[model samples]
Target: MTLYLCFCLAMALFSGPGAILALAPENEVPLHPTTWLGENKVTPVHLPKGRTRRLYFTLKKRADLMSVTVSPCAVPIEWSLAVRTLKDKPPKKPHWSSKKSMPEVWWRGSAREVRIYSYTGNDVDTYTGPVYAPASIYILRLKSNEQNTKVSAYIHEGPGPSGAFPELPSDPKVHILGVGMTSVTLSWSPSSSVVVKDGHHGSLPYHEYCVLVNHKHNYQSLCAAREGIRKERQNVQKRERREKPGKEIVWATLKDWWWQQPDALEDHASSLWDNPEDPGCVCRDVESVCTVSDLLPETQYYFDVFVVDRVNGTNAAYTGTFARTHKEARQAVTSLREGQVKWVTLSGDASSQKGEQLFRFKPRGWQQNGLLTLHTCNGTSKVKVTISSKGQVLSSEEVGHQLAQIWLHGGPSYRLQIQALVQSSSSSSISKGDSNKSKFCLKMQASSAYHRRAAPVFPATLQIKSFNKLRTCNSITIAWMGTEERSLYCVYRRQIPPDAKDIRHSSTDRCLDPEARPANERVLCKYFQELNPRRAVTTAVIGGLDPGVVYVFDVYLMRRWGLPIKYHSKMVRTRNEC
Candidate 1:
């Protein structure tokens, strides 16, 4: 009896408290009974050789188990452990063993003692298992030889209270808010549940969101396959019942086989649905909004959003949406031929002029604001132009390289005045020689009509020979010669009182008070009269001048549609009434 007692004590000491002996009627030995949260007990399970017995256990909430120990009460029992989430369904049975296999199974060798460890916290000895996801069904598939075996599973809880598990995060809701030519904006609702960590009572917020955008082609393939099936069915029904029995049946079968082939459809769909080298844009540590750019314009795109709990390295189900990018806008033409162009001579005359020649020409058909291109016909000259419309000067500047761009408003008549300083030997000779003998001529051209026909040029040069007042105190007579016999002439006169202000003097330099100056200095009081300069010397009389007042007179050589090429100005004091 003493020897028997000593032998039993020796066996107990060798096995120790952490180990369980394989015997009939399997029993679970809990290492830490105080930390025990849950246990799944399986009774005697009989399996054929090379067959597997899968045990499924669903987690009610998030759980961080310290260790999962599976012990076979019978010595000959061999087992393996595997786990899979609810989102990932268990693959079909006769499963092949590979690195890419789902429900990764770790086979514990056929031994009397088998233990798997998962440690939580900073404890070096703590063994930890895979983080069990909440609401996720996990399968602990065990396989063995042909034998009747009993198995028991002990799940050791970590630091938290027993049976207290966090629920899995809710699925995200995705929406495509806006689509641009090369970009798309997306927004989604964050998951409601937080990630539960080991030894912590509270949960951590979702840390990141993964987004995927792909071109949907599987749907198109499915639609086409259905249509092909429908057409094939109709064709089969239309065949006559009296057709050759075996031959017709064989032909119909061949036709049906052609319609059911999935190779072509699958290949087409695969080309479109393949994932890009760089996966879709990911929003790290983000909650809701994300914008993706560099997308193809006018193309359809599919989207998926995943709520991830970075603390636990777990994610929720995918949320999907789709959108199409906008098309690009067309550009406008900028050529002058296809558009309107206005030509105005702002400065130098058609002929060379000495010193400075200042003139203004209001081009016709100046409807819209556009570029102004200038051309220098003669020697190099500096030209400045001032653009004025509706009595307002819009711009005044020196044009560079004889080219200037100006903007003009519609519905208003614009006048462009060009001042050019030209250095020419002929102009200098004309200015230095006898003034009566020298003649200056200028030619002006109108803009082409609808930019189709060449502009018509008109002579605007005229020379005045003599000017004198008649016996009448209110009348005067003048004689002038023009280059063209058919040219017309206009004469203008304005009265100036002795007290009239001199407009040539600057307002700041004038000694008189502001009110003393004439309100209108540049006004022409005499009506313009047209004269036909048909003869070598033409005479015209102006009959409506104020007596005893200083008057300014101007004679202009006119063109049909352009400004005067040459003009003469003279001041005369009329004789007082007798």
Candidate 2:
């Protein structure tokens, strides 16, 4: 666990609602300036088991209505809120009012939001008391059972705004600039709204825009995020129950039942809010062009451009746009004749160079191995070449002027994709018939002799000393300290029996020794090349392993010139079935 998580757990244990209120008088966890209720505030309250917390706010003379909303963060907490009006001030000790305890409300998932409103309006039918005065104070007392959770309390003391949303800006076209295997670049037009000047010399825009991007997810309000998550989980649960007719899986929302779940499960359920990079506003405050990267290939994504009222937090979302990224092409582009080499050139025009150009080569049965080379023919733009087979990338290299070589594995067919890294200066000069634009050449030649297997060189800077592995019943997570040097890392797994004893004493170098190597080893996965190279640590998640099996994992660091250096991890046994 990280220190940050430990600190949060410690705070949750000792913190209380009154303690938090003393820290931030104006709701410690404030929402945006403008929302549906127009600057309504919220506080994160932690109530201990069988405890009551009292909160109050003064009502101004201009306001005749008071609204207080409580939303439990998790579980169906048996909670209640009592409300009463005081002429002068709130009592030091809170006494129960006329409001009854809230009823049992059930939601599909623990992360769903449930709202309970204690509203007091002048024309409300339930109210029997005289009209509330301007200087009156409203005191609220909240009580909950044995559950630790954070609840948002929205308090507003004035006439609510019209239920209708504000007008949205025109010309909301989201252009798909370019798309890659794992990323997409998007741009949109900037919008302007009416300005509201304050009593002083400065003024602010009454409306602004926020750009939200996600994989097949769209939201119009804060509550929509949680609602969408709940509906998705509910559908999955329904399908699972249908598959297992004998099993009874109740969607329990009780506080007592919720505590029975493992802490890891709850943490995983709530990770959507904790992940800073999760689907959210990529651009705000009127910025136009934005790039939403790190997306999964062959998946559709929704981009929403919402017009937000800066003064009152009302959102007018334009009809969202959806685009699906390109998947790996299945058919081979052309056949590679044995003992013959062919050169293919890619032009720099926007039409030809917008995305990755995939070229597949099918070598004849006689050809066992081949060499693939790439180099720039003209212009200053470089290119990235990746060779893959059966959707797995064997090697990837970026080259500029000099030739770059990558050995292709023995296969029936392999795919080579070239992506031109055209500079911004040269993009403006590209034309349909221009010959001076960026150009590159690709050459694949069949080779008779296999590359020589050289002894591995363990560089002091790139050597792996220690690493950590987290094991579940069916998966393992391997993480190791990273180095500044850019390289490729691949993981391979081999299963051994539980009774094996001499495996630990076996020579690790036998992996590279052709005669002594084990044939059961198979590739699992690799570290993504798109991640930051200078990161402090690199992690890979390997799934789909048999439970109750002992496995050995090996990592190979591929060198540019010599053979790869193999690093062995401590043997790990997956947990037995529950």
Candidate 3:
């Protein structure tokens, strides 16, 4: 029994990073009986930074297990907890650099809410059988990080007052109940082993499940992957510029340029669709049946069902399947000659709140750009116009009473979708059946000359101008001039390595939160802002830097869909004196 307890203690002590402790002789202190039949006392504790707090308790009567619940207050904290008995030693200060020591159970985590440590279960979301022993005294030792944290502690007896951990849940079977334009309905059977006694007093047996929906489309992923490859190749080229011959380097550069063309990249992406990788975790719900909404239209999705045990917070994977949502409208061809404008009238039906009209355009030896315009002709309603090709939406706009225009690029074939919103109207001119319906006028024209417009189109050259005068030792300002009015800019910064004397930045680095990376290359600051109409140039400041350190800052222009474009980058050094 002692050996088994020691083994479980070692397992728990070495579970997390920087968890090391040497047990000492038990220190006698005032003891309180842990609550079993009644509510456990909630003792609020305020722990100073780099300090320790201990509470001693005794089990009224030992059965199978005991649980200690530490609920945090408003502040987030990095803390570790260790429980000891009279036979075992008390927890001493942990030597975080070593992993040789052991304790009855030690847990370390950063949390802003509740954290429960079970004496019976192995701390990492599983129950490895109980290794608990009866003791006259139990000690709770807590250590905090640099933050002065506050928490409430509750010690209880038994596997849990709520319920004991059940067996691993059976895998679930998932099926598509229904699918719509922007949503997918899924249903799955309950796991046989998921029944656990969970209620106000642990008297009810209930089943719990988690339904996961993952977006299976790879269009955006393909673009991001290509961008990464392009950046890596550019880096290699820069590194080999002097070592390699001029002729070979020129030819290699030309090949790289050719591969970057849209047609070539599309073809490459198509070839990779045979065996696509699953990008997990789009949406999830704690129900057997779920309807995921606000999804992309006419896209592929994957569904998963997991049998979960609420007591121990363990999940058993069941089943998953792929499903594609219905398209917005059916396909039909519309022929338009060069320099020709065609107009069509659409009638909204009262029976349906929304209506869709789809037309396919295959240009032959025509101009690369097309113009589409829409306006409500009769009744009060709004319309949404969408243009797509190869399952990729290029442009979509919502038009009300005024005329709206959308420009399209040249392609082998394109799909046009016009969706009308039917509004209720009591006008006498409208028929009774079509009383809630409306009429819209749609005009389509093809010509290179129509490309001339007042404002610059999006995805235009995004260039970063000079920085503003807001430079300081700890922060630097980034200034950029944009051609489009409504644009989102994202900036990222990383410390330059000392070995990199002649450094060049990777333009394809993903725009992610600094907290996502480890301490080495983590971004210390983030800046995201939309373009201000009143100002001609936009500027953002990045702070939190050490003096005498060189950092590289990259600016990217975010788009509504697909990957962002890397606009520019700069290298700045902080003032050493600061």
Candidate 4:
């Protein structure tokens, strides 16, 4: 400012040598008398450097028809005025340009003479000086042409003249507060007014507002922004809701967001809507006591609510926000209790076939022995069964009419034991000569459900060959088979992967040890590359040992020793005795 003041002063007067001083004689040939003439000389109007400076234009409602002249400082240079109409009709597409700028609302031109006057004639400064001389420049000079500058023509900004909005029925006030995450809380307080002194024709205007976020910075009127949001919302038929016991005198308006195109939903930062009369189009406001069940999971939305009266389409009072719905949580199971029979997909067949595992068990609170157990009723084809771990299955089982009793070692703890229920032990209990089928009484459980727990102590492993007695006596060989990786194994002298292991890939290990070794002992025996599974391994005793001395044998294995059975195939005999 000080720099411009110094330049302007230098322009209209001179402080050079021989310049007429303030005490100079009247008309005594002044040194710079040519620059000074009248009391009010031309000087530059001080303005900011940029042309698009923030400017605010305010208007007051005048009851009578009179005119007022607002004195707006002429843009310093290289700037012009652009006027956008704020009418409530169709949405004019938003636009911008480098050449065609903001409209010129008022310009100095040949408009019916004597009404308005401003600088014209284009001529560049002849003096090539660094400093600007106000009197030498165009437009910059305060008083360029003749008469004490003609007053800008009067504009009757009265209530009703030519181009005036019909009287507003309400005193509309809107508040815009930006919320985080590109959201905002918009609120408005409005009171309706009457159009005529006695009749009911006032603009019962609904206070609608679009954020126009990051849009025109110096918009002069609130009504202009309100109408912009309202006009666009009408096309979409968006609904506006009310908060509570208040009368819906006004329609809810949408949050006006700036966009190049209207159809795309992605880039939109705010939700625009109208009040009911426009129902169900937008989400209901949470403040209005809406139910959670009414919403779907993972939905996106925004809301606008207002009052509607016959007198007023929508009350100016309105509010809105953005929100989403939550998803449903996992469901719980009922009916089935703990310790039930479950079918082990591979309880007995884990080793017969070589392939990847088939199924999985989601362990529940009381799950033990995850094998699929069927009814051990009278009409059943029984097979030798084995098991290792419990508590892995996570779902309940389907109960059937037939009675099934797992060779479960009944104890408080779901532990492992070596035994099998009689009825469930044979393929079919029929006499070979007489062909007589037999039936037996057994205890059956009603129902069961998935429960995760420690594998309860149960009869899983027993070491004996085919049940029928054989004629000749030879060498006794033993082999252990089962994963030594994690499960308990026994020596199944002439056995393979059980029905469950072969199918489910369970960690159930069946061993053929003469004696059921304690869980703490290493069941693994020695491994030989040539020893094939289910192949007999013979050990000869020079002198026949006592006819039936149960001999426990040990072989090297990979299970901290060797994998039993196929890997640990070898034989041992009772102390030799003639």
In every candidate, how many clashes are there?
Answer: 9, 4, 2, 89
Alpha-carbon lDDT of model 4: 0.28
What RMSD value applies to candidate 4? 23.6
Tens digits of per-residue lDDT for model 3, 436-482: 33455545444333434332334333555445356667877777655
Residue runs of model 1 more than 4 Å from their true location after superposition: 1-173, 178-185, 193-453, 458-543, 547-578
Select the stronger candidate by lDDT from 3 and 4: 3
252-333: candidate 2 lDDT, tens digit per residue: 3110010011122234346433323343225534556666666667877776665555444334545567778779554335
Q: What's the TM-score of every candidate structure?
A: 0.29, 0.34, 0.31, 0.21
Model 4 Cα lDDT, one tens digit per residue, 76-162: 122222112322322234333333322221111111111112333211111111211111111112222322211111223333322
lDDT of 1 by residue, 1-578 (tens): 99998887778778874333442123232233211224432133444556656554444545566444443432234554434334443344525555432222212111122223221211112124655555343445555564443443444445442221112235445777889997789887655443333455543333445555556421111222333334444565567455665654533322211111122224433543332233334464444688777677888876655554443332343446788899874332122231232333322342343322333334445443333334333324446667666668787876433222344443234565555544467645334445432322222232323332322232333334335435246766665555433455555555655776783331121111222335543222222233443444556666666677666555554433323333444556556774
Which has the greatest TM-score?
A: 2
Please, what is the whole-model Cα lDDT of each candidate in the order they appear? 0.44, 0.50, 0.50, 0.28
| Candidate 3 segments whose C-alpha is farther than 4 A from its true place | 1-55, 62-135, 142-156, 159-161, 164-180, 186-287, 296-333, 338-578
Ranking by TM-score: 2, 3, 1, 4
Better of 1 and 4 by TM-score: 1
Q: Over 4 Å off in model 4, which ranges?
A: 1-524, 531-578
Candidate 1's C-alpha lDDT? Answer: 0.44
How many Å off is the CA of 303 in candidate 2? Answer: 7.0
